[model samples]
Target chain A: MNAGQKSARRIAASNGPIPRDTVCFSCLHRLTHPSRRPASTAAALAESPPIPSHQQRHTNPPVTTAKAPRKAYQLLASPVLSRPPLLTRDLTSFEKAYYLYQKRLNERLALPFTRYFYYKKGTPGDAEWKRKIKVRKTPARDIGVYAAYGDEGWNDEVLVGDRTAERESVVEALVRDAEGKAIIDEEVVGDENKDGLAVAGDSKTGEGQRRDLTKVEVERPVGRVTEADTANDMRSLSRKMDRTLYLLVKNREGRWRFPQDRVYGRENLHQAAERILVQGFGIDMNTWIVGNHPIGHHQMNYTSGGAPAPRLAKITPNRLVSTSRDRAEYEQEEYGEKVFFMKGRMMTGQADIGKNEYGDSEFRWLVKEEVEEAVTGGYWKSVKDMLAER
Target chain B: MALLQEVTSTFLRRFKAPPASLHRKWASHCRHASTGAVAQETDELEQSSFLQGEGPAQQAIERFDPAGVAKRRNRRLPPSRYQFRSPRYYRGPLHPHQPPRPSEPSSREFAPGPFSLPRLEQTYHDTLASDYMVLAYAHLPPGQTAFKKGERLRRWEGDSPYFKNRPLRGPRGGDTLRLLRKPVTFRNVPQLQRVTVHTMSSDAINSGAALHVSGMVLQAITNVRAEAHEVKKSVAGFGVRAGMYLSLTCELKGEDMYHFLSKLVDVVMPKMKDWPGVKGSSGDFSGNIALGLKAEEVALFPEMEVNYDMCVRYYLSPTFRIWLLANS
Candidate 1:
């Protein structure tokens, strides 16, 4: 037979249980509506009946012709749809939520994340030193900054694209571009390392506030960050393996949402922080503040010149000790000789993302830098000073 | 990217394909025909049932019975069967357990080889369409009757026995069942696997969309007469009925609920064409898929409820595996 006929025969031969015509007949016989209502369709399928499927064989042979069904009569004499060992299956709520996400989220469009184990250095008080990380700060650091994107109820009161969250306004989350190099630069405004940075929330909450919020955490080297030392020298660093840059999107409900992979990493990181404070010189002489820190936070940040910085991008400090103990120990071991470790007063901070800055639509904060000279010129005393300027 | 593995094309490639143990070699065979034992049993049953079904044919054949049922069969029959039962039911000296005993070689060119397929225990089916497609559902109008299998499809002058004067065909069962165009060869070694059955309705089937069914039962029926026999083993001697299949499947799934009936009407029944001799299309079913895993994790169920008057009907679809890959 020619290939077409050969294939047709093969198909027909391979088709088990029923003759090809019967299947064709069953298809049309079961058709509640003609696939396409060609004027000739009714004429074509006139002999067919609608074959309903479900449960058990409700009615076998929905239609019978004088020709009779000589095909699978043996099938007709068989058992009803029920077979033995009935199916049992179950799913949980979170699993159901994951399934819901899986259903609606297109795999192709799905961006994912991965995490590795390692500890970070410093206490929540470290944010003050994290920005001054010896690691060369670049324009990229400014990209994720949103000055107004602080913890003060910004998330609840305003939504995405709010006038305040708009790029054009003073309330907008903005970062100084290369052209405006002097905006956040220590050389232009004048300030001490890590000293000017403060949590953006109620003053009381700001105490360890930066440790409570959800933010992108890029591990960097912490040359020697002690809970006593603020983040005066933390630098956001990236490793070749650390290619993931979490971009939290907003769900329809206007809540910041990340994929499960990202969430897993964030949660793990939170549980991996240490509450002990490093004893040493900080913002001023005798401040001697105790602060929460990821023990190995120092290694998480580094200098662009490849040198290890003293801190990294501020992450929510984990108060629960066991989860963050490895990190705490790693940092303590790495810099234990240089700094003294001590427990501090609620070294934790209130850094959760809130609607205080922008209305509750989806939004990401972009940190900007003042002109490189902003700090060296001694123009700003604290992050409040910087916020007040704009 | 290259394929993780490949199977060469050749005859002995599957069996003697090496590294495979002698036991496996012996176990993995498709017999040419059911053994004389199975044949004897099935034939006796088939004869009794056939005789009980239609009397005239049996009377005509009885006159020639002097040679006996087995001996007089093949020799006296016409060379080909145009409007008669298949001779496949005959035992012809082969074991049903082995997929196929090597067929006796023939001199004819391109002679079809043995029926070397595995035991028809469990099978999967899928559509062969290559383009992106969807399932749709529709219902018959208020006054018009549902389209009949052999009757011509009637036009709705926007009128009908349907409440909406519309004719609605259910979801993608035809396409789902279409996958059975070729029965797949799976292990007959008795392993667990999930068989997904999708249920969809008329409007959904017509809309050209994949139906989504969740938290509902799914079932499927392929044209397997041997499967019927397998089901009959339970009652041992009682006559097999279409209804028995459901309970058998439900029992296998470990569910005591009348899933077969629910699954049949809720899922499989709506998509099935009427089988001959069966009366009502909507009744308790005794069958459902013996799923190996939670369908939600592996497959999706079609969910679409049409509300027209206060009444609502659900739609389910068939679980299809062999889809026409778009890239192909």
Candidate 2:
């Protein structure tokens, strides 16, 4: 037996005449030792120097000790008064409150987050047919910010005008003279022709004027080829490995896609996907989810500079961008990059085309058949599993 | 003259009163007529004491045998020679599980290959079309009949006189009636299609750690990271803003949805203290189901269970919205 139990036995044996109080060892220890007495007689103990341990006895009936020790002894002697082995206690009010608050927060966050998988929906219109035909002499590559365009009210004429402007820019870039002056004065002539087309297209729709204005000032880079354009083409060379479903954007490249951005070094696939949707498509992150899990992961090989490399885009704390001239030194080279495709649905609003800073002409929420028709080969095969009919 | 007048009055009074006692006696006699046969049979049976403790009179009770006195042979016809037989039992020389005989390679083309693929032309199904899109329960009208299945509902209105005149020769032909006769089973009954998870911060609006923890917790539960859901409008009461990262959310559908439900109901819910399950009254009366979960209760999920000690301090109760098709 430990010291406390030994002391208990000694006390019990010495006080044989009276019924021994089979009190708890800790309580008995307190009684036998004068220094560790409870504060019930603290005042009396303080007034006089504490009774020495050797002189202390259970029979010594001091006035201050009499009432307190008897009560304590009675409580200790009770069979039901045994202490638990672990000596744990129930949570305090403050801790309980904190737990409750935390619980409430989890419940609020655990509200089932919904993600929607939308395909490019609608019958191919005349303008859409024209956009599908490659206007640029160069192939349309997978680079640049392409995202789901949700707004449907925008007119096709504006999109057409935007396209023509983009074509003109490309033509100008391709046909530049040695002095960098345009050999073609076709822009002015093209403008006049487009204006005529706009008037005719406008007579068919009410929003003709807005369409005309947006064609000139649309933020999405239409025909301009960036580093991403070349990189995307190189990366997407092998159709066997990489699979991607493209969104059909009217007046822009027909192949817009579910928004995806480059993953920052620290961020994971889902975080990057959410970031892409929010920044590129103007989706409300809190209201929607990319998906409960990634539908698929696609890897593509590419060559940057001269060596075979994976495409890497510069990631700012808030947004992802293609490498710029100023930040070239700091640009981190990422190779063999993997893209995770997830299903996303809007909880509050339809596709917010207004927030789509990248210029996509119009959005069509496609069905499974339409999605299959819009995308080809490996991408369609992967996407077919995740298709949501509703 | 007085005697003659009194006699005439008495005669008039007698004609007017017309046999009151006689009418009552006739009514009592009719009542007895209605019950006479049944009452006689019961009275006879009771007097005989047939149903009382066994006596000599109890043997008078008769019994009927539904199948007659003797049992008849119960048998079925033997199988026909043309009936299909299982290959395992009769067709194969060896057991069905036994491998095919190994042979030396004749040619690489003739040899069994490890992989197989369909031809390009044969890659797709021809029946897939947009026209087949049928919305299930897009809306629900109230009432008992509205929610019940197997009812013959007028899904379409054939106003044409031609259709009305030739019901058997309509678009569906004779099968139309048969199709209508098929009772709507539970499979055909509309169920929840997907569940949406909406996560919001219960802590300070701008606490980075709280948002991070919320996102991580959601990720662990779903096996996919939670996407940030920005507050669309600023609320003074909650100190939220239009573009602030308010919470994270994700949608679970098909396998993910059912799997999560199984975990929530089977694994997590039983561990919670004093937790009553989703109330029947909690339904919107259409078809959608919504339930709230406390953070502590959510922690019981296998995903979050292991992390209790290093628990994310901030918590937010989340609502799970199960979307189902409403009765159209």
Candidate 3:
């Protein structure tokens, strides 16, 4: 057995009779031994001065000893749950111009349209298509360098006006006109009904008109900017359409940080993170922890009597022996706390933090840059690399 | 530029040739013309004169109706006259005409599509990939020595004369060398390489029906053709004879692999009666994971469910072994 375990056994033997309700000597031995502690505690011990083999007996205490070992640092699991971008990032003006130029070049180089393949001969639809093509007035297919300088080429001279301006296609314009007319007809019908007049002929004529075969019906795409974006609503998940949004909450101390909770008894970091989400935001938001491991970590030392404790430096064996007289004072120092941040993805739903639950706390969905500004300098330095650039 | 120069030079030469030589070339071209001799003559005449009057050709073009032509002629049109047929076998690079690569549409072994991008693939590209890189990262302080690993192959240490020039021994406990895992970066994130679905049925040795059924079921579910493998050596305990076709395997890649995985995870696995999950210890140390499916579980697939009666008639109960390999 190691020196710590042997010392614990010797102490227990000298103490003689133990209470029945209390923990057995073996359990106490396991808890008191530094070698038997968890990996995190073992790592902490590795950085501290090693106790001389002869001093091992005095370092540990028996059951009758009033003072217990220094309390382990409190661990907190902070989960940074985020929503991925809904839309692709906006294109720059240069990109827009380049794409348009490439598109026009593609059209010029493409094969000549074979009208017979798409439309039958002598039909009204074909006639309409022919008229539309005539209006477009595309140049005929030609060979050699002359084609590059032709009127249809993607040249600065040909496109002297605003090059990147979005021009409505023929089909889009036709669709828009049809929708406008329908809306106007509806308004007219509503007015006639209010006046108690029967305009049957006009309604019949409007309904009798057939949809244009050559004109395609295109649905206008939804706008990228939402109400949340316009109002600058930091609480809304839909505010940023093209950037990753992280959920940050204000703690009782009024510090802005990621949603976090203390690591409870016998629970791992990821499990504590899962519990933190449900307790802080209720059982509504659907968030998934990416993995069991922590993505980043931050450590803070507690202040003692209004002054920060001296930072611990690596102590050599010779130096440790020389200062053995002050070992008691060194052992009593508190190491403060460590927070392990776990990465997660918020698939759906929002954080519903009840006022009574969190005690006047608030939550905001912030992007990378805003998060950096919201948290402290040290906190941002620790987590800046973990956040996605976009 | 050289190709363009060659083309222009050849064209100028052909254009400036003597009348006698031009006539000779035309005669040779007509000789090579197969069934379109008349059409070729018409095309030459059209090229000779760019301007023409309002003739019968213009009237015929105006009157042309494809639907009427198709209705009047009730038979299917003849096969395309000059359609290229890719070479069946690859001769060599030195051959006059080599076969096209399998990626080309005309190649004999070409397999098309990736017709649609799978949702899982899109999610991987957007999120999982970067997260994985960050999770696998390990930071080291400046001026620190890198971690050194012990030598894998053992060296001879004895002073014997025979040991002086001997080769290093294989790793302890096993002859196989384990794959080295490099630090994950943006370019080297782990990704699914391919999936292999394998099944061996001893019943196939006794009857060919079992083999046929297994092949059909595998192809139906995986969207890839299954290849039958014959037993090289007989195993008495397994009750198989040499040279008997006893196994079928289907390898899926790209779109097919994603579709199969998504379907299995989203639909089939959840429908199973009592499956917990693929065990945590299912993967080989080298990054390939295997999962087995019972006969009933195999039947849970949507493709098999559609033709459940047909599969039941043949008693399709071969256990499926699926292996998912990842590129690290």
Candidate 4:
């Protein structure tokens, strides 16, 4: 055999196989020489595949079974097994309030839970879903505003305004010590902790900040609501939704529109809008976005009061037992009530059909095409305008 | 003096209540008085001796027969008496075809006769009595009539498709009733094809330690050392690039597989919270059932669980894919 053939055979014998490719020559040379290789490699190369002597050295020492503790398998099977210990303690009132407040705040500020998605049933631009938003006026107390602040206007404590300057101010006030000096830094007061409870915002502020009700001499302009006062910020749906708007429909009656509610005395328009949403369509204000401002408004001539009424009436008018059946309970009065259409983004709650003014109103989330087909007359024109803007 | 005394007594009776002795006599008269019925019955029995002698002179004794005694030992319970109220027998027919047969009085014309004998061929208005077959049919109730069976038997007289190529066996050696056919042989092979642990992380591309630790975790959990694989293509947006060790995978077979599976099913899986047992539908149609565990859950293995706190954050939960090969 030639010298090259002999070396190839020798290399194969030492290191299994050597590929006749680039850069393998050096590895072959290293395998042939024991002195050039590392001690670990040399030791590994000393043993063959099936039963490696080097692996034997690495094996764990034989365990002395004589006095070893009984294994899990060897233990006597008992009827009752120990349970995992409880990891929590009953919450104190302060902790409970803190968590509850945090939950509400999170729910209010968190992104809408549901995404706007619909199947393209027909051609694009065909109205699918239609809904009407009802607007009226009611008393502030009915909308959960208990104690009114003396024309500061409404007490931030009593008012369920989506946002107020006093909300941050109250938190700023609580961060101060008994001497009324700022204990925490200004930044900390503004910053929400991991729990998002606004560590500075205390439950005491909701009660302690209540001021006595007093009439103000100065004329306070009403209906001045901004985006901050309500969570009207348009949130993009998570999925790639088709360019379609779904109108909320009341029942199977093709009369599709956003459910509307009345504005109560002492209640801001946004609060009234949410109240209407809750009562009319069973949409919880917490889980949905009721715009601070009305998207559209229409005037209807009916026996109604334009200005906020002293007391709020039920959304569903109750027929008085004393009144005659022939006489309409809700007869037109002297004045026309201006109805505002507030746009709302549905988040996480289901509409309670049982709570609807009209018995058994089935709310359908219909697409743009279906909405156009379902709604007609003045409603159709208004909806068309709304869709045009989109 | 007598007139004065009578007037005084009369005046006293008129003015005051009656005397106590008179009231006692009146109370005794109002009370129910008992009659001496016992004495009268004894006197009557003594007078009428014939009336007492009407019944048997002595009590009847139970007779013991030898045959009856022997038969009692071998007495087998009647099948009907054992479950006499069985629903199978007592329950009315679900959908009876005909109304119940009405009873008819026996007549002379319908009496039994030798109608089957050809010598006694006689035409009569009572067809059932004249013909034996008709009589037999009449004897049976409507429900028990074998008209359908007789028709089915007669149908085989012509050239039958079932007996076209084969000779028909007589009533003796016909088709015998037997149990169902043999059970089907299943070709499903449950051998472990391969065991792989896959991990994906943006951090691994930058820090080699992440890849090493992942491989270590996979090896520690499975007891089979894993090989680290790198992403061949660069995806800049996700920070994934070529030659970046993105995953660690291991394959197990034979004993290693058995040990891993036992630990997974017996120990690891049961410890998981909110785990509704794996549904039968949770597979890719193939035999392989892909099971995923959270990082904290995968740390339940002895090796990882021991030093869990130390490398808790570093441990990325890799999906342990167990492929089960089946013989097609």
Lowest summed-lDDT stretch of 10 residues in model 1 chain A?
A: A74-83
Ranking by lDDT: 3, 2, 4, 1
Candidate 4 residues B1-328, lDDT tens each? 9999999999888978656678788876553222112323233344465555553333321343333444566666576763222222223566443223222112212211111111111111111121222112222323332222111122235666776656444343455422222212222222245555565555676677776666767776765668778788988898886887787777765445556666777788888888877667765544466656666677777666654644555546444444443221
Q: How does residue B61 of candidate 4 score in lDDT?
A: 16
Residue-level lDDT tens digits of model 2 in B1-328: 9999999998899778555688787886554321212323234343455546454343342333222222342653365642333333234556554333333122212222111111111111111111111222122223212323333333345787655644343344343433232233324443446666666775637677777776766766765557787778888887777888867776765545556666777787788799777788875555567777766777788867645434443445343333333221
Question: Who wins the lDDT comparison?
Answer: 3
Question: Per-residue CA lDDT of candidate 3, range B97-216, in tens?
Answer: 788877665567664443444666765676778778767766554543345566888898898898887999888889987778887777889888999999987678678888888887
Better of 2 and 3 by TM-score: 3
Better of 3 and 4 by DockQ: 3
Best by TM-score: 3
Whole-model lDDT per candidate: 0.26, 0.42, 0.66, 0.41
List candidate 3 segments past 4 Å from native: A1-79, A83-245, A248-342, A346-350, A355-361, A364-390, B1-102, B153-179, B236-239
- Across B83-157, the per-residue lDDT of candidate 1 in tens digits comes to 222234335557442223223111112222111111112111111110001111122335444443432333444
lDDT of each residue in A227-308, candidate 1, tens digit only? 4224332112121111111112233554432211111112322221121111111112111111222111111222356764
List model 2 lDDT by residue over A1-390, tens digit each: 235543444554353332223455344445556566546345544675554465445443221222212211000000000001111122333333333333223322233322110112342233332232222111111111111121211111221112222334434434432122223333433323332134334445643332342233223334334354455532221211112213333324555344444444344445555555555446442333432345455554456777875444443433353322223232334455455665443333334556664465555444345556655555555445545322
List TM-scores for all candidates, in order: 0.16, 0.22, 0.47, 0.20
lDDT agreement of model 3 with the native: 0.66
What DockQ, between 0 and 1, does each candidate earn?
A: 0.01, 0.01, 0.05, 0.00
RMSD of 2: 42.3
Candidate scoring better on DockQ of 1 and 3:
3
Of 2 and 3, the candidate ranking higher by DockQ: 3
